[model samples]
Target: MITEPARGSTVTQTIDNDTADMSDVEAGAFADYVPSSELQKVLTEAVSLLGGSERPGQVAMAAAVEQSLRSDGKLAVQAGTGTGKSLGYLLPALLYCLHEDARVVISTATLALQNQIITKDAPLAVEAVKNVTDSELRVEVLKGWQNYVCLHKLNGGYEGSEDDLFSTMEDSLAPGAGGGGEAASGRGTKTARQMRGFAAETKKLYEWARETTTGDRDEAPRGISARAWRQVSLSSLECVGEKCPFRSECFQVSARDKAAQAQVVVTNHAMIGLEAAGKQNPLPPCEAIIVDEAHELDERVRSQASTEFSANMLATCAKAAGNLGVSGSEELSQQAIMLGVALQNLEDSRLTQMPEAVAECRTLALPPLKAALTELSAKSGSDAGSDGEKHADAAKTAVAKAALTSLLDTLETMTPESVANGETILWLSRGRDGDQEPRLYTAPLDVAGKLANRLWSEHAIIATSATLKLGGTFAPLIHKMGLQLEEPQPETLDVGSPFRHDRQGILYLARDLPAPTRGEHPEVFWDRLVELVEASGGGALGLFSSRKMAERAGEVLRERTDLSIMVQGEDSMAALVNDMREDTSACLMGTLSLWQGVDLPGNTCRLVLIDRIPFPVPSDPVIEARCAAVKRAGGSDFMEVSLTHAALLLAQGTGRLLRSAADRGVVAVLDSRLATARYGGFLRASLPPLWPTEDAQVVLDALRRLHQKVS
Candidate 1:
């Protein structure tokens, strides 16, 4: 650890010192030693490869490798952009893996980062390690099933043909229909004509891909479509695992097998969450895990755990159940009645205000659920027909049982404990359109305590992100993770970016603007947004806090600008980004999805406009309970919990700007609170250190200069 000269600071530490020709440090204690001159040479090579100068993040990571290895304790590093963080952690983990002959799992926040590591950084880092020493180490990328195309689905074709579905699917798969099959020009720019011309070529290539067995899409980035990917992707509910006929040829399994043999495994956040949640534990217990772009983990976990019931899902399940034609059909119908009865009881207008009936249903729900599971178990075991037919019947019955059981369990969990400090609320919501079936939503009062207990209790963990520490401390966020220690010894480090933020970037706010009511000032907001986009000559990304707002704002802007506008729901996220990149003057208006994973550098994106700070939905059961819990604990929920979450998201949203040192952009926050509220300082502190400006002309001038340079 090197210390800079300041008012009263004096420190003695080695920056880069070669300790020895070859040495072995304890797997957990590697961070204790200063990098010898020999190690410095290795660091220099990595830095050069990544096109970054040595910075605090790099230095801290080198040190953390030693500390995280030696103590086997957790470390939270806040490495900003342009810090070469990917290499900062990767290089150290690589060295530790080689020395200890142990495997390392590196989890990142996005597929883009995972792909970059597998395709670019890991290969180069492997070579860098080899240059430093002749040690041989293997590295591989691991992703979920959806990342690869299902050859069976593409070639063997699916069952049923209601809407010329097979023909439509085939045509889409055919090189250029843009129907949602894989594309050769994964760049997402191929027009319909070009796609058609290339369909045959893509089919031939896909056939070859099936035989190769790597099945990892990162190996071939462009051939898979969003639709095809959905069919192949596996969630906890859908993965038949060993039961799938394709088990032997399973791409997910094959990827895990490769990872099992490799010293370093590159993967994404959700997969890591799955492992941490004890869902996907495929690889050998890793000795160390490096998290790149660690800031996005919480949101990723929330999304992965979120469950929404819809009419489509209900109707599909019902039809699939109905398709079982059997003598026991009446009994099956009765079992379905249990679900309907429970929902109907809650909906009865006469019982709607009755507290006792609602309480009784909540109380008796668990027993019926258990009985249903037992009955369903017996039915599944009884053979209905041929082996395949029986299997299908059993699967359908089991799915129904599981869904019902989950509903009951969720409800049970949502009930507040007597004498509990906080309240738990239940919400019933109907699907879109008047006729869609209604659904129930149940959420726990708080997830932080549960998250911390699950992640930190039994395992040696490291949680790193660009904005983990807000207001110069991490207590609030750490508490949310359920870390409870008087003095949690988790190592904390910040790698501030090397970007010329003070000179190249500015933060603009509509402070004088009135707060936006739910339905008011939308037009005014859109008008201001259009003016900013025009002044910047397009090349902007508009981030809305909600999907409704994003769509509404997008609609308003579309009529006002000649620049192409791509909204989130209109197309796949990948397609939108690809389009945004291709059109220099295009404006991509999207909800929170564009906030973090997006990466557009240089003049391709010079302005980022945000509609508001993304606060969690107020009606959200989990968030509401968490806030209430904080209040019950005699703390301000807004300051302790809600604000912390918002600050982290705000940091992520603003992070879209200035991706690299050479990148320059204006980050415009339409939310005036960012410029007016007292807690605004906390949010501002969380952002990348940038010059603050309220003058619109100054921002316009900077955009003009950037536009001129690009032109």
Candidate 2:
């Protein structure tokens, strides 16, 4: 572990927060205006209100965060489950924003946590602050523009010709419509069924927009299904900001206004990545940042930095031509047809499969498409004055122009060699459900350098997550985040889990089981799973390595056992979890996603079955390339990257077992490698300190006892 430079003065260690000795905070306390005692007072009151006694770990985290933000230094905190990490970070962040009259941004990895912070934690903290300091603290949540309702799209979409929008093009060179079927163009068939479904969904969205207090797509009755939502929402490429009649009530603008006025802004990781990458956005600038799920930061940044161009874009260009009714419409339409056909044919020749071919397509088709777009642009210009009750024809033309120009700009950047480079991940993916050509994609091989340059260097960042350190060291994360091991290094602390893991959890490795060969779950494994579930009496969460394994096990379990088996995709995620919680005898099985962000306390999940070690697919181009780079740098990619990744996942999967003090369970790793393989000890260190056992009967008996006690 790399130690930070010594502060001029030491943090006075003392007993504070009434019940706990916050040694972690006092270890390197902030030398700022607010005293540690004062900070602790506010945090203690907030914790009491949020329904927990004072936790030493939480207090220490709050102090470390306060020090980093006020001093403009970076800090990495690993606050384990039951540490009350959210309130610890938020209370201090809110107070700092209020004191300095500056905005502080809090970023999470998902919408669920973003909403939770704004709706649940933020409000409580605001009230807590008011109670303690008699001051007001305001918070607002911000998402990307596309997440909001676009009144322009709502009013202008389908205005030109509903029939034309879904018509099958007659051009033989174009990639014909797939109509959402299993065909060459999966979404080629844009027929009545497709059109009607879109119309119905849009109508509902339109009605909701008028009445909704918050025009967030995630809040709609029907969640934002990409295909359905795209019909009514506008990407930045399609939006004519502040130009339409609905400008005053524009959801995006209003959301931005609210965020600007806020002292503390709650947002997702994507927004942070975008801002760091130098993309202009509506989110407020911050004095300090608190990244809650910081472990995923580098990956999220890489994903955001990635840009792709697909053939479905040709449809947008073609629609723009039809909508404008311009003089060059015929020429633009022909170019669109030619480009789509060329892209699809190139893909068929395995252009993306081989790196060399992806580079060549740039020479063959890119220049011609750009020339056609320039000619089309010269033929038509925006009509600013446009209004209508039935159809916004003039506005449609302006939008079409914007969409076409954007497409042209995107394709212009992908050079043949640049598209197929060691630093880029290139692939071929089919376009959306419609008459669309497959898209050629190139994303960054890794985000470490970009994030290190863009985010960590500029802001006083507070990176916090339960699983930031694999095997209890922040070295991997620090390196990946582009931080150094030398002086001025980020301060670090690992406030361990508050739960009594030694008593509350049991670690059972099924050593008798065979090795997982070629990532396949054997029939014997399924039989053992059945036996375990039967013994546990169905408070089991069967987490598998693949969807096929989950589905197969689910089917066999349903046939072999009488317990209600709920599998993912069988119903909505929320619905399935709710159903499982409502019934104690229900066993829910799913893939990788279930490993984290699950909160099934008490008897909802008394046993967790890990079918195999969670490792990245060896064939994934990105992973392979990342490993190659590590090896070239004189590092063991398997240990640093692969082992670390699997360990973090195992830690996350096991963390689900002991969610609360009252919760107790068995984390059974069915693969024998975790017990027999050389890497088993390293992996075991990632999990909680549970009572280890190898006897199958011992685990079965314990499960039976737990089930009996719960019942």
Candidate 3:
């Protein structure tokens, strides 16, 4: 174990003992080793340039990351908030790329984090590396094809189709036009106003698309909605590839080209997951992968690996086949109807085995789908010959072929034999309304095996996050990631936060409050919540487990007091957070996303109110299936699946307080479970070591004092 030194102190510990054993290996095995002094010097210069002070945890983390990259080993780091984790990993990644002349891929979970690394962190690291090594290093951002505007779609290529952006805008401008549906006979004024807004935003996007060189959606005007962007962009399956006249100047291709030429490539977790699923290798080959928000990797990979089948999906495939002049298009459409009927008859639950009716529909549909795909593939390959019509036909055929190929792959995965084999989990999910259709979904029961085979075996991995180790240890996450089975098992490190949690914050456990029931909290819970907000004079962040509870709390607080209250769905998250930051007396209430996504520093956020322990709903199909698997293996499902989920979220929620060294606050858990339940100790260990108190008045007094100080 490596112990991090005190704040502003230099780290003296070497790499872990296991790494020391491999220090004398052959030349080519670990060739890109950079001395620890060089890493520290680069980090020091980067910190100086960024106008930040030195922290021992950041120095320790940088050394650990460097050791992992140098030994070609795996590591998981838990660097708490205020540790400067981005620079900790970036400096080493940049140094490795400079020394070895090999590419390194850095993946993050969110677009905000990806943009932060590229725009803020990477450039400073590059400069630091250049200052030390006297060599320029290149870095590029690579995203999915849909993230950029499609030239073919932006032009008049799909002019007559439902995908045409200009046609959609024109329709929106028509009187009584309801966007997708036909004009309502007497549409209300509100509907008309909304359509006009959509039209205006779409027009702005169109004008911006014409002038932007990169075509990246992130660079476009801010007001555009996702629905408008879809009209101008293309999904991977919708792209015509080399058959299009705009192939050479394609933005997605250009981004990939730049990434290929760079030494460090920044991408997202979903892209890495897609490559692991054998869908497509969207990333450049790299010597190592540093997953920065590492806690979200497993769930993100499962999302990418999951497949869904719906009537609308099949109907769209049929329409694409019809566009390509495939003969069996009608048959495929009929099968889609049959599949929808079969799914309607079934309840929404995880399947122990595939139903006969569903299996029959899938089996009957495969042949015609395959035939249509074959014909489309042939047409897609035929020469366009210098004629404009022929070229358009070729491009359309290519896109249709890709769509059919994707449909075929989904159908094969849903085959009865595949479902019965115990390798996949199949379930049926319905939309929120009764009128909406139910869809069949399948995902790998476990992604550990896939990640181990496809990712860990190929590259050195450093997975770092603020919440990687739940319940006081890394074993759970390590086992979940399948790193326990690796040849050279991953090393673990916990470079503690720079903030003095005990001195800066309090963990207030409401021991007298009743254990929360399933639906609504008791009246007493609301009373206590109001009291806390009043005590703090309202710089509070309310973290709820459900939207209903969050909204109800907002209503109660808004009625009970005069402070400004903001709910999650009332406005954009960015707007809500900004409002909270600007007005120190405002309260922002939201659900799961607010737990880890927000970073509100200073006196603006002085209280974090947690409604209860955030446990996964037992009725969720994936949770049910995973719990069953764990129980069958003779393990406690509560500890493995349920408790860990709650613990991780609890840690993340607790972290919302004390964002900086000077910040002070109280993380008040309104539920008594964290103080009286059997698992309380485990959950408490996962959080920052704050001063704990059970007396409500003690916390109220502390909050009042902090409020007075800030006021």
Best by lDDT: 3
Candidates in descending lDDT order: 3, 2, 1
Cα RMSD (angstroms) for every candidate in the order listed: 9.8, 7.3, 7.3
Comparing candidate 2 with candidate 3, which one achieves the higher TM-score?
A: 3
The numbered model that scores best in TM-score is 3
User: Model 3, poorest ten-residue lDDT window?
Assistant: 11-20
lDDT of 2 at 337: 63
lDDT, candidate 3, residue 217?
94
| Reference-based TM-score, model 1 | 0.75
> Residue by residue across 1-711, what tens digits does model 2's lDDT show?
112222221111100011232222332332332336667778778877867676667777788788888888888888888887888788888878878887888999977678788789889889888888899889998899878877766765435433222222334324542233466444455455677777777777778876777678888875445666765666564455544677798888888899899998888889878875666667777788888988878788777766655444555555556555544445545555655565666542212234443334434445544554565455434444444522354345445655656555545545555444556666665543434446666566657677667667777888899888876678887777766532399888777767656556677788888899876677888889999999889989988888888898899899999999989889888888889999989999999889888789877988899998998876565677778778988999999889888998898898888777677778889989998889888888777777677767767777887777778
lDDT of 3 by residue, 1-711 (tens): 112233322111111011212111122322242338888789889988988776777777788888889889999999888888999998988888778777899999998889998999889999998998898899899998889998988996755455211112323323334544333533555667888998998999999999999999999998789878976887766677776789899998999999999999999999988877888767988999999898888889889888877766666677777766887779878987888788878998889799898888778778888998778777767775665776677656655666667778888876677677666789987754434467788988788888888999889999999888888999888887777778878988887777667667778889899999897999999999999999999999999999999999999999999999999999989889999999999999999999986989988898999999999999887788889889989999999999998998999899999787777889999989999998998999899877677778767877887777778
TM-scores, all candidates, are 0.75, 0.85, 0.91
**What lDDT, from 0 to 1, does candidate 1 have?**
0.61
Higher-TM-score candidate of 1 and 3: 3
RMSD of 2: 7.3
- Give the residue spans of candidate 1 off by over 4 A: 1-39, 48-53, 145-212, 215-247, 275-280, 306-332, 341-426, 432-435, 484-488, 522-530, 547-565
Count clashing residue pairs per candidate.
Answer: 21, 10, 0
Candidate 2: residue 679 lDDT (0-100): 88
The lDDT per prediction is: 0.61, 0.71, 0.82
Question: What does the lDDT read for residue 189 in candidate 1?
Answer: 55
Q: List the residue pairs that clash in candidate 3.
A: none
